[model samples]
Target: MPASAAKSTIALIGVPLELGAGAAGTVMGPAALRTAGLRAAIAGLGHHVVDEGDMDVPHAVPEFAPGELANCRNLSDVAAWTGEIHDRALSLLASGALPIFMGGDHSIAMGTISAVSRFCAEAGRRLVVLWLDAHADFNTPATSPSGNMHGMSVAFLCGEPSLTPVLGERAFPALAAGDIHLFGVRSVDAEERRTLVERGVDCVDMRMIDEFGMSALLRGILDGLDPETTHLHVSFDVDFLDPELAPGTGTTVPGGATYREAHLVMEMLHDSGLVRSLDIVELNPFLDDRGKSARVAVDLVGSLFGRSIVHRPSPRA
Candidate 1:
């Protein structure tokens, strides 16, 4: 059983700009989450909510080295953003507040997770990541064809050399390769596929979702968690859901988890109480209609914070 973080203060820190991804519109995700009433929702659960507001991220226009993968672009600004987020995340952890990182893109995980890793290393606790995304996101400079940094978040976090300098003095802290779990993956490039396979990464893809349903997958992941783990950061890319359910993401994959399926995962996560931090990334409001995607994401986060569908009791005739 994991020690509950009930007494901890929760901070909603938004990185409301996206130069780190292949598309636009996700920069609006931070505001969307707040507009969807994140602070109020979390407070509804009897927890104190504090909105630290958005972090200081650079504009998408590039200034730094695009590096070996020129196509990925934004390398310099992304690196600088890492430094900014690293400082903020470290402060949040030291302050004992459970920081819920509102994302501009998945790239910020490289910063948030890295800070958590460093804290855990010194304080003596394990770091666990539940990477729930549609794509594998393991691409490196050599392996990546498109060179998008969002596609390489997992690769960078695992201490891949292509992103070392981006670690920015925080390189000493990182998680063991086996501690990360890649769940709900369906799309994979040839290089990412090979790397994930060779690294012995635990990936429960859409096929598995089809074969066993979400309950079994949740059971397997929860079973792997321990209370001693310092933090369980859930990096949820909206693309993990089928485009039918979540259509506003940069990367849209077919056959995603239905609403009920997504709700169940969040509900179970709430039950486990292992999750500490989170990322709601890849939601592109520019591509959405009447804020459909934003609303769904809000509902899902509600489930994570202990909202349920069984609020009413069945009546007998």
Candidate 2:
């Protein structure tokens, strides 16, 4: 088992801004997670789970004009959410809480990661992002086939010029491309694949997982970390799981991780005690089958915080 974090407060910040996504229902993701007992599940792990509630998109726009990225849709709205979330994330970290950034879409990562990067920089620590998703999400506005900002999140965070102004007046510590690791990826755009190779990112794709197993591939990632100096941030997109198991996500990719495979990943992360922050994104409850996906997400969170299958407690009747 991994060591436990010294910090006891788990702050939940919901980013219910969906304009970053190509779909609509992800705006309700936070509410769905809460409804599925996320807070309760975390509290059950002996952590103080504080629900900060969903962030409200600013009605008043900032003075900095949104970038005119041609292929990126809803640039202004995404920029607004990015700024708001960045502020909130920094505040949560300052309070000495391990923040769980509940997302409306994968694009919200632009804010969460930006804030964490800044916080780590100020603390003189290194920030490593674990991107668990189906797609690479490394497309720039110029390379993106779709106009969805979610597809361009990874690119933006790595200092892509297309969305450079998304952070507004606040300074963004752009993450080093090599520090971002992609896991469970099975889908990638032609251009995005090229970008990943050019950036020299460490991607443990489905093919590799099939060959060496998730545990071995993930262990390689965990082994390289310096637990004290590395502030690990896990950006989990629901579509990283096979659609048959997590059908609520808008961008469903086939041949993703199974339920047990995902649980084991979270369990390993729990033992590592290196994760300081997290982002649970791209869950669209509107497409779910009676909250099945939400329940699975909750279960995965349970595993992340040290819930083990062998010693699991029984639910109330």
- Candidate number of the best TM-score: 2
TM-score per prediction, in order, is: 0.91, 0.94
| lDDT (10s digit) by residue, model 1, range 112-170 | 88888887787777788889899888898788776668888888888887678776566
Q: What is the lDDT of residue 260 in candidate 1?
A: 91
TM-score between candidate 1 and the true structure: 0.91
Write candidate 2's Cα lDDT for 72-148 as tens digits: 78877788888888888999998988899988999999988999999999999999999999999998988888889
Which portions of model 2 show Cα errors greater than 4 Å?
1-7, 62-68, 311-317
Worst 10 residues of 1 by lDDT: 308-317
How many steric overlaps does candidate 1 have? 1
Residue 261 of candidate 2: its Cα lDDT? 98
Q: How far is each candidate from the true structure, as Cα RMSD in Å?
A: 4.1, 3.9
User: What total of clashing residue pairs does each candidate reach?
Assistant: 1, 1
Candidate 2 structure lDDT: 0.86
